[model samples]
Target: MVVPLTVALGAGPAQAASCSATTGPYQKQVEQFLGRPVDGRQSSADCLAIQAFQRKHGITPTLGYAGPLTWQTMYTMYTQQWAGTTPNKAGKCPTNRGRIACVDLTRQLSWIQDGARLKYGPVPVRTGRNGAETRTGSKKIYWRNINHWSTLYNVSMPYAQFFDGGQAFHSVTKSMWNPPGSAGCVNMRPADAKAYWNLLRNGDDVHVYGRKPGT
Candidate 1:
């Protein structure tokens, strides 16, 4: 479909020989956008939400996974809702209202408000190549592409302190699993970008910890 074509063609194919292009992101998108867990099981509310979401967004009501229209629509909803809510955090946020801190791990994602309490926003993401691995350190967002109308945000890599010239919280092509995949950047589902953007500005801190232990 054109939706798959857009993500795959724009982000490029996965480098992992064992990784399939349409698996992870596909699963992850459905779960998060549908407001369900990644187990493929749906709650009554989730099913209802998906139906309403699809109808409102003009999705075709396919068998599984979401199309580009559904995806875009969900992004709109998340961003709109997040805009009206204040980020729940502990200590002072680095910038952008000192609200939320977004952390992307290989498995789950969580946002901290007031720097203490946590709200789970476990969306999927694409990661980097094996050796090129996403990093675990703090860094500021040097730039942003709110429109994301072009491939500029898709193809570029995110730089990190620990991971060095690699890693970023960026977008990916293929469908993502719980953690998704990327070349090093945090793979943010397109739908989640706007909400994410709401939490920080150009100089806000973005910490990525793709691994465990002394990362």
Candidate 2:
């Protein structure tokens, strides 16, 4: 899909490289993006750091490798989502008395808007897969859990904002891009999740539509 390239929290590629890139613009880019100094080589540590950033930002595969998409994404970290202009491919979000979050399954983008005013988003999100599809339509956020643990999945669901029964909007440090579905929740990057936790509150409305791909 040709999405607007927006992200929720912040904010690669398949396979492994023979070695870390040592001498390149990308080396410095990754280093700066990660807030650390790199040796200008694609070291295993570099791979891990890169993948960690990628995963947190919902980059695909978290491949322990960096490719074009990864590089471009990192390069435009602040510029991409801050323009305050809605994406051409963005879907319509509802206006509410309080905050409303719009999840467009078809476009794979989400944004929070009060009518036409963009408060946040049109950011990338991953919803539940086929049988475990996240519900479509509108619902109110019934609860908020900062450090929620899933007994069923046995995973830590941080910054969880539950809108449906057990499903919620939460941050994932594991995999944001590649997905088998979200076990019926909306998965966001960690930074976006934190931002969302700041923007939304209990009883806020959430609208979800379309279908999650790769089911």
Candidate 3:
């Protein structure tokens, strides 16, 4: 079973206290909402602008903190409403000769970095059944055929494989949308898989771990 994660926006009492001042709270809130970290204390305008951004994401304006409603809106971004919201930044990734990639199989998601900046998630995925679970260990992006499509894998997708072991990340078919239905590989919704593939590069880090707080 997958444990549901209560979106970590770090808005507990400690954070609240640390955010007592104008700079601390505003800075923290902006980073928490945008998924981008801030360097130091921020100005009131920054806080207000962040509040505006939050409103765009369906959250009502408030004291500019990542409170329950804001976090809930962010949660919605990862769930059913993700397609309309995911930023199209296929050209944003910094490409180089070699890079490492990682995935959290249990969470049915992956994380990528172009040697800098931690991109938390676009997390859209499907997992294996009780018999065939997604493996966890070191892996690499052995190929980069952008035109590849999911064939016997059962989904029409821009696909890639690691080590020829048959494990891969690709677009999901209708059958695999539910948990316990995929054929032992990670399955992703069409848009998320494509976006992820675009963000990935050859030799990017791919770490597949077990059950996260929420699968």
- Top candidate on lDDT is 2
Q: After superposition, how far is residue 153 of candidate 1 from its true place, in Å?
A: 10
Candidate 2: deviation at residue 57, Å?
A: 10
- TM-scores for all candidates? 0.42, 0.60, 0.45
List the candidates ranked by TM-score, beginning with the highest. 2, 3, 1
How would you encode candidate 3's per-residue C-alpha lDDT over 1-215 as one tens digit per residue?
22222222356744331111244323554465575556555444445555555544434433445455455334433543443323223323333523434454433445454454444354556656566666666666666555566567555545544422677777654432342345566666667667677777666656566553222
**Backbone clashes counted, model 1:** 33
Query: What lDDT is obtained when candidate 2 is compared to the true structure?
Result: 0.70
TM-score for candidate 2, residues paired by index: 0.60
> Model 2: per-residue lDDT, tens digit, 132-159?
8889998999899899999999999999
Q: Who wins the TM-score comparison?
A: 2
Off by over 4 Å in 3: 1-99, 147-155, 161-164, 173-177, 211-215
